[model samples]
Target chain A: MIAALLESFAAAARGLPLTLAIWGAGVATGLALGFVIGAVRFFAPAALSWPLAAVVEAVRGVPFLVQCFLLYFGGPFIGIDLTPIVAGWVALSVYGAAYFSEVFRAGFMAVPPGHLEAARMLGIPRNQAVLRIMLPMMALAVLPSLANLAVILIKETAILSIITVPELTFRVQGVGSATFAFAETTLVLALVYWALVEATAVASRHAERRIARALAA
Target chain B: MSAPILSVRALERRVGDVEILRRIDLDVMPGEAIGVIGPSGSGKSSLLRCIAGLDEVSGGAVMVEGRQTRPGDGAVGMVFQQFNLWPHLTARENVALALKLVRRMPAADAAAKADAALARVGLGALGGRKPAALSGGQQQRVAIARTLAMEPRVLLFDEPTAALDPELTTEVLDVIRDLAAAGTTMLVVSHEMGFIARLSTRVVFLDHGVVVQAAPPAALFGAQAEPRVRSFLQTYLDRVAWARDA
Candidate 1:
């Protein structure tokens, strides 16, 4: 069983690069989209905010797996075609973005009005105030939730296996079936995911501490 | 001779149907210190905020240095009751940010001026500390330093020491006293009657968004003043005396 597990690990390791790529790209795209949409929700004029809120609400209301299926399998009807990996990227990013936007909005709302009011009274320009005063302060409050979203995205990458993306889960399933070592292969996959989530949590905790200290100073 | 450095003519502020301030007229000349005194919700801070252009006035214009100024115009600066220093910036950066943004001073020059401002507030040694690390009084002083670095034509302080402990209040008040002595134009809205009595060249007493009286403290505090003003003072003095005894 040990030797079989080692073989499964080696096979799964080949899938690590692609898995990380999807996760990284998805998180980056998601965070960027989330920030923009969240800002619209938080500070944009009412006319602009309502529509953006509708879009965010629609995306979040659907299940992640269904969204992935619609993007990957449902695209041909609309004459929009994407490769399995690209579809996986879009699906996870959109899903993650829906959650991230809410987190960012909450963070912005959490900021005391006094901070921005002071900035205005000091004659700081609006753009500079948002960048220097609002966003950084919001990040200090929202970062842990963002880190959690990254972990969720990392796991969500597994769903891409159904679309024939050769991610960790896909490769692990292949190894398990070929060798009939389902138990060992599954165990290794779980351990790998556990490690990833743990790393994310630990890193975010350290970031939180550093930010708290800086804010306290 | 010249127009008052900062002037508010017939200012009115309304939120929905509620009137926060009404037909308020105030003129602040160079080297003059005017204290605004009133009970809570008497439009004291509202008047200050309008003069600073922090809030929109439904009617009337605020003229800074004899011309209308808008928000972010850098003509006026205000210190808040809560010492609204930006938490992320250090003391030096907090002061320097205004200089850099409003005055368009070069970074090096801004930093030097920030240091000078901090020193003026007796916080030169703590310039590197963030507001959260400082005491409440120190934080308010940093806020004052930030406004000073802008070199605004008039500084409006909205209950500047309201959030401080009695001991801390003096530390912040001392900085204001220095500024007042140096002939800085100021409009202060405060509940600290003693400070108002000591520092104001003229004091305006407000009630229900109306100026009850605008006079020197001696004129307003004595039995010779209007009955309402005298009554308010008597009540305020009694509260202060009770607080002291407690």
Candidate 2:
């Protein structure tokens, strides 16, 4: 069992690049879309904000796995010939974007009314005020939340294995099926994921401490 | 006589269902410092907000230097009650941000101007520090520096030292007095009777969103005061005196 666990760990390590690629692509796309959605929600009129809110609510209510499966298996019927990897990336990006938008919106709301008033009284244009004064403050406020989202995105990459994307989880499953060593392979995969989460948590803690010190100064 | 730097005529404002300010008429001449005094929630801050073009006036106009403030035109600078310095920006950067973003001043020139403004507010050495690094009085000075860098024709201050300790309050008030001495056209909303007494050329007393009296600070606080004004001043003076003692 020890030997089987070591072999499974090696297989998973071989798929690290694929795992990282999915996570990277998904986060990049999600962040872009999230900024747009968050801005629209913040500045749009009630008529617009309500519909956007409904869309965000609907997306958040659904399970991510179901969304991935629907996109990967159902795309062919719509005449969009997406490979399983492409489908998984697109699904995860869309799902993650919805969650990220809410996070950004909350950060934007945290900015005080007085800051904006000060900018206006200085004769700063509204758009310029938002770019210079508001965005930087929002970025600092949202950094911790973004770091947590990064960890979630990394773990969610494991779900892409359901679409046969040949990631860490997929390699673990393949090794288990080949050698009939389910317990060892699954345990090793769990350990790998635990290690990844632990590393992410440590990085986030360091980032928060840095931010706190900066704020204190 | 020279034209007033800021003029407001019959300004009316309503927030949701409640009227916040009503029939507010004011004219501030160049180089004059006007003190606005009232009880809490008497709409002094709201009136200042309207004059600074930070709030919409439901039924009046604010004119600065003969140009009426519209949605796009920039005219006035304001210092808030809470010292709204951009937390992420250093003192110099916070002041420079307005010059760069609004006036489109050259980066070096804006930085120089920001430094000068900070120096004027007695915060020359603290220019590199962020608001979180500064004490409350220091932050208020930075806020004043930011407004001064804008070089607006009219400067509006909303309860500038309301949130500071007495010692810190004196620091902020000193900067404001210096601005007045330099002939900046200022409208200050404050509860500090001493500041109003020493700095104001004229004092406007407001109550329930209306001006009850407009006179020289001495006259308003003297035996010539209206009955309501005298009653209000008595309560205000007593409270401030007690606060100082405590």
Candidate 3:
């Protein structure tokens, strides 16, 4: 069982690159979309904010698996063809964006209204005020939430295996099916996921410290 | 006299159904310090906000040097009651922001000017410190320095020392006196009667959104004044005396 576990770990290790591919692409795309949507919802007039809020709520209301299946299997029915990897990216990005937008919105709200007004009173243009004052303040306020979202996204890449994206779970499941070492394979998968989360947390801590030091200057 | 450097004409401010300020008209001339004083909820701050262009006036206009302009037009600088120093920035950076943005000064020159501004306010050695690290008075001084760096034609202060205790209030008032003596044009909204008496060339007494009287400190603070104004001043003085004893 020990030898089988070691072999399964090696097989799963090969899938790391693909797993990382989905997580990286998904998080980056989601963050960009999230910032835009979040800013619109938080800062835009009610005429625009209400519709964006509805979209965010709708996305967050559904389960990730249902959303994934809809994109991957539902695509062909709509005359849209997408590879498993492409579908995985789309589902992960959309799911992550719904959650991330809320995180960013809360971050913007945390900044005191007085600070923004003071910036404007000092003749800092609106766009520059948002960029130089609002964004940096929001970033620090939202750092921990952002780090947590990254961890959630990392773990969520496992869902991509359902679409046969050949990520860690898909490959590990393949090894288990062939060798009948279900328990051993499961243990190895758990360890890999744990290590990934730990690494993310460590990296987040380092980033936070660096940001603090930079702001101190 | 030559046209006032800053002018507020028929300024009215309404928030929802409530009128925060109405029919407020005042003019601040060069080398003059106008003190605006009134009891709580009397719309003193709102009037100042209108002049600074911080709040939209439902009616009327604010003219800076004969030009209709908005708040932050590089013509008027304001020091807030809370100081409102950007918490993440050092004292120097706070002072440098408008210089870089409005004056378009190079980074090096802005830093040097920021240093000189800080020095002007007796904060030269504390420029590297953040607001959170400084005392309340020091933070307010930094806010004043930040405004001064803009080299505004008129400075507006909204209860500049309201948030401080007695000791800190003295420190901030001392800075204002220096500016007053230096002939900087200013419009100050303050609750501190002594500070207002010492620094103002003219004192505008406000009550219920109207300018009850605009006169020198001596004429207004003297025994003969409007009944409402006299009563308000008596209450303020009584409160101070009570606070000191308590």
Candidate 4:
């Protein structure tokens, strides 16, 4: 029993790097994409904002599993082909982008249009005003939500195993089946995810403290 | 005689079906403070906003220093009623960051200039505090410092004291009064008639989206004022008196 448990644990641990890679890629790309969409909605005309809004809505309203399957399995219909790993990253990014955009939209809105107008009225360049005044405030407001999304993406990576991405869940499930150490494998899987999430929380908390100190009145 | 430093010709503003301002024309010579006064819904703020490019100009032009200018032409600066300082940054940072970003000043130069601007506004010691830590009056001064550091050719003040109480109003008004005395070349829209009568080089009265009168303080507030202007002033003064007594 002890040997089987150790074997399953090692197998699950082996998938850690791949899991982190997918999660990090999805989050980084999603955050960048989300920021663009959120800002477009805030600064652009209704015509542009409306279409982006629709895309965000559809991505958010649909299940992540369905999105992953449709993109991976249905890609050939549109002359698109991606490896399972790439497909999982893309789906996770889409899912994250949609959710993170909503958080960002609220953050940007909270900064007030007056700040931009004040900057403009003072002859401050538009980009400088946004980069300096608007973005910093928006970043502070959205940090907690963004961190939450980062952790959610970590768990979302486990779903990638369903697409045969050979991530933690896939490897651990294989070990459980072959060695009949289902209970031990499940415990190891849970512990790994817990650790990743706790680490994310700690990092986020640290950043919040740093920023809070800087912003202190 | 010097040509007008700022000119607004046939300015017409329409918001949906309503005409907020109609065919308004005016000019401000250098070293002059033009006070804009009117009843609520009388397009007083709209005129300032139109010049600042905060509001789209439906018709007409705003010419500053012989050039057609919009916002950020490095010609116009406006102090808002709300004192719209970025809440997260220190007062000094608020002033310095704009200088760095817009003027391309180096960090040391920006910080030095920011301190000087703050000192000019009597807020030198409060420079390290954020807007939230400052009083409404101090925040407004910090905002003025931020605008002043930019050194625009024209300043448009949109009821700068409208958001403050009587005591706080006095603190901010003193700073602006000094600015006017120093010949900053600006237009001020305000309800503080006493301050307007005292500080303005000329006063423009707007009614029904039109310039009812634009005259020196002595004329606009004098018995010889236009009938509409006279009646409006009488009513406003009477209301102020009533509020004070009540």
Candidate 5:
């Protein structure tokens, strides 16, 4: 049993870097795309906003796992063949962006309209007002929600293994099949995810306190 | 004698089918302070907003210092009832932000000017605090300092003391009173009867979005006042007396 556990652990460790790579890339791209989506939905005119809204709703309504399959498998039929890793990354980023946009849009609405008016009255440039005043206010108002989405994105990366991406779940599953240590491998995998999520929460709390102190000072 | 520092010509503000203000004309000479008083929804705030170019006029013009003014024209500064300071920023940063962004001042220079402006409002030592950390009065004073640092051609106040307690209102009024004494051109929309009476060079009473009476404080508040103006003052006095008796 110890031998089986060690083998499972080794396999899981081998897949760790790839899992983290996909998650980090997904988050980086998702955040950039999501910010644009949210701003357009909130501030753009109806002609431009409606189409983006439809796309966001369609992406959000679909299950992320199905999106992974549709992109990885169905792409070749449409002359857009993507490798498993590329397919998984794209699917995950788009999925995460859809949800993250909602969080940002809500945060935008939560900020006081008076703040922007004050900025404009003071002669601050429009772009500066949005960047320096509006975005920071929205981010501060919705920090916890953004952090929560980030944690959720990390876990969602596990689903990427279904498309044959060699991530933690894929490696652990291989170990389970080879050594028949399904229970041991799966248990360790659960613990790994739990640790990552807990770390994210603690780091979020630390960042929040630092920001509060900066604001007060 | 000097050209009017600010001019509003036939200002009209219509929201959908409702005409909130119509054909309002006003002028403020250099060193003159105008007090605007009226009942709620009589377009008192709208007039100030129009002059500051913060709100669009349906059919009118706002010219400050001989140029047509628009938002971000840097022609006017406004202090709001809520003292709309960015809650995340310190008082000094609040005062310096526009200077850095709009005036394109060096950060260090802007900081120095901000500190000086804060000192002018008697908040010299409290510039490091955020709005949340200060009293309602201090926050408004910081707001005044922020606007003063910009040195706009005209200053606009829309119910600057309405959000404060009586004690807190006194501190904000003191700052405005000083500004008036220094001959700053200003248009104040206020309910503080005593402050407006004492500080305004001329008082403009608005009703139903038009100027009902415009005169010096002595005439506007004296026994020989406009009947509409007298009734308005009477209503205010009645409320004060009722509150005291209660």
Candidate 6:
């Protein structure tokens, strides 16, 4: 069992780069889309706002695994051929973007009306005010939520194993099946995920404290 | 006297189903310090918001230097009661943001101007600090410095010292008084009767979204007041007198 666990650990570690790449790509795409969606919801006309609202609401209400299955299995029916990695990126991006949209919305809303008024009074253009004053402040307000989303995205990368992506979780499953060492392989996978989340949480806490001190200053 | 720096003619504002301000007509002259005093629900802040172009006037118009005040026109400078300094920015950076973004000043020039504005407010040494690091009064001063850096012809303040302790309130009021001395045209909404008495050239008394009395502070505080004005003064004076003795 010990030897099997060591072999599984090495196999999983080999797939670490792929896991990080998926997380990076998915988060980047999700963040961009989320920002655009959140801004429209906050500032666009009701006609435009309603559609974006529907998209966020529908996506958020469904389970992420179901969304991933739909992207993977449902794509071929629509005449679109997507590899498992592509399907995982699509699913995670959609799922993360919906959650991030709400986070950005709350951050923008937390900004006081007085700040906008002060900017306008100083002759800052409306777009300039949003860029210089509103966006920076909102970014600070939403940092913690963004950090949480990142950690969740990292964990969710494991779900890609269902579609046969050669990620950490998939490697662990493969080694366990080959060696018939289910408990040992599963324990190693669990430890890997635990370390990843713990490191992320510690970094996030440190960044939040630094930002809070900067904001207070 | 020089032409009025700001003019509001029959201004009205409605928020939702309720009318917040009605038929507000006023002329603010250059270098004049005017105090707007009113009860809690009298729309004093809303009136100032209209003047600052923070809110649209439902009816009538506001003309600054003969040009209509439009969104992002950058005519007036405003200081809010909450001292809305950007928390992520240092005092100098907060003050410079308007200059850099609005006035399109060079970075070095904006920084120099921000430093000067901070110095003017007696915050030169603390320009590196952020709003959270500063006390309430210091935050308010940073807000003022941010406004003053814009070089606005007219300044509007909405309840500038409402959230400060007595000592901090005095510190902020001193900055306002100095602005008045520098001949900045100011339209201020404040509940500080003592500051109004000492600094205001004209005092506008508002009640229930209407201007009940527009007079010198002395007339509003003295025996010449209307019965309504007398009652308002009595309540205000009683509070101040008690606060002073205590």
| CA lDDT of each prediction against the hidden true structure | 0.88, 0.86, 0.89, 0.89, 0.89, 0.88
Give the lDDT of residue A7 in candidate 1: 88
Q: Write the per-residue lDDT of candidate 5 for residues B12-101, one digit (tens) a residue.
A: 999999898989988899989999998999999988888877777899888888899887677899999889899888999999999999
lDDT of 4: 0.89
Q: On DockQ, who's better, 1 or 4?
A: 1
Give the per-residue lDDT of model 3 (tens digit) for B40-70: 8889888878877788889988898899877
Off by over 4 Å in 1: A1-4, A179-181, A207-216, B240-246
Error of 3 at B134 (Å): 2.0
Candidate number with the higher DockQ (2 or 4): 2
The better-scoring model by DockQ among 2 and 6 is 6
lDDT of 4 by residue, A1-217 (tens): 7887788779877888899888889999999999889989988999999999999999988888888889999996998799999999999988999999999999988888889888877667788788888888887888889888888789888888888999988898899888888888888889889999999889978988798677655
Tens-digit lDDT track for model 1 on B26-75?
A: 88778999999988899998898888777889999989877898766778
lDDT of 5 at B228: 95
Poorest stretch of ten by lDDT in candidate 1 chain B: B220-229
In candidate 2, how many Å is residue B244 off? 10
All DockQ scores: 0.67, 0.58, 0.61, 0.58, 0.67, 0.67
Q: Which ten residues in a row have the lowest lDDT in candidate 2 chain A?
A: A208-217
Query: For residue B80, what is the lDDT in candidate 2?
Result: 86
lDDT over C-alpha atoms for residue A41 of model 4: 91
DockQ of 1: 0.67
Model 5 misses residue B149 by how many Å? 1.3
lDDT of 2 by residue, B1-246 (tens): 988888889999998989989898988899999999988899998898888777888998888887888532556778888988888888999989878876789999999999999999999888889898899999999999988887777788899998999999999999999999999989999989888989999999999899999999789989788888888899877887998999
The TM-scores of all predictions, comma-separated, are 0.94, 0.94, 0.94, 0.88, 0.93, 0.94
Retained true contacts (fraction), each candidate: 0.74, 0.65, 0.61, 0.72, 0.80, 0.83
Error of 3 at B65 (Å): 2.9
Model 6, position A201: C-alpha lDDT score: 84
C-alpha positional error of residue B59 in candidate 6 after TM-score superposition, expressed in Å? 1.5
Give the TM-score of chain B in candidate 3: 0.95
Displacement of residue A86 (Cα, Å) in model 3 is 1.7
